[model samples]
Target chain A: MIPGTPNTVALGIGAALGLTLAVAILVLIRRDHLYIRQALWWVAVAAVALAVGVFPAGMDYVGRALGILYPPMLAAVIAIVAMLIKILLQDVAITRQERQIRRLAQELAMRAESPSSKDIS
Target chain B: MQDTLIVIPAKNEAATISGVIAEVRAATSLPLLLVDDGSADDTAKIARAAGAIVLTPPLHLGAWGAIQTGLRYALERDYRRVVTLDADGQHEARWIPDLLAVLDGDAADLAIGAFPERGSAARQVAWALFRRITGLGFEDLTSGFRAYNAKAIALLAGEEATLLDYQDVGVLLLARSAKLRIVEVPVKMRLRTTGPSRIFSSWWVVTKYMLETVLLCFAHWNRTGRQRT
Candidate 1:
């Protein structure tokens, strides 16, 4: 019973597709590979949204299958997935930098202590 | 004469230290002062046994720190010139004579030994970057094998030497700021015998070293500029 005339459905699909393409283009231009991955995920979500919005029956079927309480629940799920992936990737990068710092510190300390004694003699 | 003294900074290099000491001893009878930078092994004992007057720091100072300590010691003992040599078996002892010859013939304040072949690709890249940033024409800025006359040694004996993590490049920069004459002599460098390189293990290590070296160069440039003005 959500108001869905042909004109309104076309407008909704057009807006979503336009926004997705614009965001993907911006992300790609930024050259951050991680952001590009997120943009792609967002584009897929928008595509799905456009498809379901144009077909009211399809939206109702998906909502019912997922037991989604509201029409926007699917969009929320997509956003959460994207956020989790970003956080995981950031954590991995930070851990790698920390490991490199630790190794360098250890090597510097060892080099300082034993001064290539055998070679000098 | 009493114008030059050789300072060899040694750590735990007992096996090759004797041969190196013998070679240097035979090459030139220049009074040798060895700084034993807290070696866990018999490095200090062996160096002393080999007729090198040894000075042991309270704790283990890194290569630069040990070299600085040696410089300070020479400064205190009234030595006019100091030739620094690596305790590692890599640097040929024969090069010491050549470095000294350059210092004497040219009346150079600072004489650096340039290695013909520095094996590692990462090291080559790092050296290239250093040369690009510092604009100093010396091929091997990191080589510890060099001779410093009193003028150059005095410039480096200041408080800045204690703060330096790497002395070779920093000292050279300091010499330039002090208007001391600098010269580079070609010397064949061999691979290090004791342990693996602390830097240049992988791409990540190379990146880290490059970052540190770049920062150090910037720091030296700023300091030198400030001193000049």
Candidate 2:
């Protein structure tokens, strides 16, 4: 009920957006296009978005309680933080994969160099 | 059988690969492995033709990756020591024995063949900064010419050292953390006649290398402990 709160139309649109995101992610997961580990993050984001949409005043209340001067900025801040964590996690995963690939490449080369039992004996 | 293995990590150094291999072969009968880092040229074929056992990664694994591959190979074959040299002909084959001497004498676990005069002014500045930050006393911090014993090879070839992008500061830091004694032996080096340096190839690469190395130094400051000669 706060001033500048999302109107009914905006709330509906937000809800629809959240619903669409949730459905899209689920379908992607079902099709094996998205990993379950990563889908957990999107699922949480969707849940939060759906909650905020259904209770538009909740964000304002939380924002005010946290002493945020501009309520919508809280969403932006949270979004940015989440994105940062996601990107950092992605880099961590990439680092691990890179290491694994390097080890595999080394193994392959070593195997190719080593003569087979038939040749060695 | 020679207890030492010479590892030369080459990338597109087909022009110099044969000469480098021959030089090492002349210097010592130690078995040499040329880790061809997915070179676009015929580095592998040329090296193989020159009587070197060539190990080519299916894809490019950068400098450190290729070196680590060599280390792993050494470790697997139970080699007592490993000496790594550049394929670009900067590192002198004559100094391999000198580097190994430090290890054999038990004066150090790792021996670095340092030619301080080989670096440009900018490289000197970078080396000074790295020495200041890491407290490593090496004059040639970026020297690829180094000798490592079985102990050092085992540690560096393991998963713990897998993610390192550079074999310079990171390897030194890891060695220090493992309580490995490092010593620098003065050596003569010729100027590289082949491809550009991997680290100082471009201004952007230099900047990135500086930032990443500086950050790495700070991150490992506490764990690396005080430097030892």
Instruction: Pick the TM-score winner.
Output: 2
Candidate 2: which stretches are off by over 4 Å? A1-6, A114-121, B227-229
Across A1-121, the per-residue lDDT of candidate 2 in tens digits comes to 7668677888899889888888988899999998999999889988988887778788888999999998888988988999999999999999899889989998998878733211320
lDDT of each: 0.70, 0.88
- Clash tally for model 1: 13
* Per-residue lDDT of candidate 1, residues A31-59 (tens digit): 76546655765566656655654565565
- Tens digits of per-residue lDDT, candidate 1, B46-95, equal 87777777767665566776677667667776888898888776777778
| Poorest 10 consecutive residues by lDDT, candidate 1 chain B | B220-229
Residues B86-142, candidate 2, lDDT per residue (tens digit)? 998888898888999899999999999999998989999999999999998889998
Worst 10 residues of 2 chain B by lDDT: B220-229
**Cand. 1 TM to true fold:** 0.61
